[model samples]
Target: MLVDDQVPIEEFEGTEFPSPATVHMELRYVDRLLHIEGTVDADAKGVCDSCLDDVERHIHVDVDERLDPHSDRENDPFGESNVLAGNRLDLADLAQQLVLSDMPMGLRCSDECKGLCGICGANKNTGGCSCENDTENHGEPKMEDAAQ
Candidate 1:
């Protein structure tokens, strides 16, 4: 079986995608096991961790799992393989799970991004702020004062 659909981002909280996720799924039933495979593509929008700027990132994830419809708690307590629910499978939920797992821990506009200044709340990448010099000597005492 094959499925192609768009999953809305509203289903997930604290996550935003430029548009609905494109999901392509393929399922094969062999003996008592069902093999599931799919791919999800989306452009996620998030705030940069350091600079607090809007950042858009493209995400592509692959999914692969095996489910045993016959397995139950008594026989498979640990659930080595996922169990199917009735005769229906929720592909949207599965796609969201896969995307969440593949998301990066932190998002950045660029690797060399200069984050905002803690004192003046200025974006260092755009331009330097007066507080830049002040923060440089915040912790260290002046040599003349220390000597006195």
Candidate 2:
């Protein structure tokens, strides 16, 4: 069975995706096991970790899960394996989990971001500020001290 749907990003709170997400799933049932393979595509909006600027990123996640419909729930208290509830599967939940897992730890607009100046809160990438070089270098010895 093939299922394709678009899920609104607003329904999921605490997620980075700001736009609607597209999910495509292919399910194959064999005996008591259901094998699912899918892909999730979305645009994630977040603040850049370095510069604190608004950033929009396109994210794609691959999903693969094996669900057991006839697993003994009482014996496996922890539910180590994915189990189906009755005959229904929650595709939205699965897609959300997969997307979250694939999201980057630190969202950045670019790898070469200059970030904000520590002293004056100036955006260094756009232009320079008077406080650019005024911040103290914590560990390094001063050039005058080294010469002395």
Candidate 3:
């Protein structure tokens, strides 16, 4: 059977979504295994870990899971299937878990991001801060000047 639906999820991996994730998948049950294959589309809204700037991006996750309908995922902590309850499947949770597993940790707006300043707390990518350069010679103002 073919399934088309939208799952409303608040956030994934500490990143919020601008809208619901559109799920398009094909499900087939054979013998004792249920095979699921599809794709999920979402718009992620999050802050860059480096420069702390607002970042948004479109994420597409390919979902492929083979679940045993009779297996109990709750009893087995290491089991891969957790979206199934008896004969029923939770599509919303499935989408959320799939997206969460696919998300990357510690996101940055760009690889060239200079990040924030340590002293003045300014974004280095946007023309840094004055405090960084003010302290010269490894942040020491000369021993003679400091003794005064």
Candidate 4:
């Protein structure tokens, strides 16, 4: 979870990573600084950007950081900050920041995911609808929409 001192960074490759992945941390004490270099892997599952069906995707990240011990502000040279109280450090906050930093801004299952149809609620991936473009301005309105 947290690597305080200096050690080999952990490997989180393959499918063991969380849905959003956690940055693999390798710590090293250099003079008066802590250096971290590693990677993060995450397999996320969410509705397709084009379709409303479940889709799974992977996110990968490479991280390299340095933390200064004597600085008034416990911020890494990379501009990422860690709350440090003397020699004692908060691992929870550090991990949270790493995970958040590795998270993708915008992700999709596939570039060509044909999402659900707006009119008939049909999945376009399985040829459930012959609406051609799957536009919202199609055919008959649903009972819910008609009542409104």
Candidate 5:
């Protein structure tokens, strides 16, 4: 059975996160559990780990979930509103779980990202920059080579 007839939560997917490309959903209520199925488009931007340049990546999110009222999780670090009470349920938690569960831990624009140069702090993704190579005074092995 559907909860609210006036405002449908299904209308919110594509609008809230329009850059992902598309979103479609199917929701059902049964035995105090909410079954959800959907797809979402997502775009994420962050500083590149290598060059420290702004990086953007787009991803597709597939959503399928079963949600039951969780009243005992007052200690959750994210927040308390994730759980609903009584008969009135919150669909927001289900959305949050689906998004968080599948999010990539290491996000990069590409696999071979030439990050910022250590000597000059130039964005290696762009190209060459003239910087002093401090090999003697620093006396430390190349951090990049160690990583490799």
Candidate 6:
């Protein structure tokens, strides 16, 4: 069987999906097992962890799993896909799980992002603030003395 469709999912773990995810998959039944293979693509919008900037990401993931009517999730060495509920696959849950799990931890706008200034509460990447942060000392020690 050929499955090609788009699924609309609003949010996952605080991250927002601005567009519907495109799924192109093929399912084949062999013996008592069902094999599923697909590719999922989506656009995600979120906040940068460091600078609090609006971060957008394009996610593309590959899915490959096999399911059966009787598969053990516990106590057995081998288990089918966790997206399987009862005798059918849960497409919505599958999309959310795959995308969220593949998402990066502590998403950032860039590697060289300067982030925000703790003293003046200003964004350093956007030309920085006028606060005297003791630039001569290389860090907060100079700012401490300047404040005193």
Candidate 5 clash pair list = 20-41, 20-42, 50-115, 50-116, 51-115, 51-116
Off by over 4 Å in 5: 1-23, 30-32, 70-89, 130-148
> Which parts of model 4 are misplaced by more than 4 Å?
1-24, 71-79, 83-86, 133-148
Cα lDDT tens digits, model 4, 15-53, are 123333444667677887877677655565555556656
Residues forming the 10-long window of minimal summed lDDT in candidate 5: 4-13
The global Cα lDDT (0 to 1) of model 1 is 0.74
lDDT of each: 0.74, 0.72, 0.82, 0.55, 0.52, 0.77
Per-model TM-score on C-alpha atoms: 0.71, 0.74, 0.79, 0.55, 0.54, 0.74
- Residues 1-148, model 3: lDDT tens digits: 8989998877755589979999999999978799999999888889999888998877799988898877755665457767886677888888888877776787778879888988788998888677767776556768658889
Q: Which tens-of-lDDT digit does each residue in 1-148 have in candidate 1?
A: 9989998654234448769889898998988777889889877888887888888888899878887867743566556343344556656666766777677788787888899988889888887687876655863567657889
Per-residue lDDT over 62-148 for candidate 2, one digit per residue giving the tens place of the 0 to 100 score: 878887766633545346233344456666666666776677788887989989988788878787775644544533457758889
Error of 1 at 126 (Å): 2.3
**In model 5, how large is the Cα lDDT of residue 30?**
72
Stretches of candidate 6 exceeding 4 Å from the true structure: 72-80, 130-133, 136-148
* Winning model by TM-score: 3
lDDT of 5 by residue, 1-148 (tens): 4322211222232222324234456768778566657765555555555665666666556766665544424434354434443444444444444444455565555788877778778876666764434553354556656888
For candidate 3, the per-residue lDDT at 105 reads 80
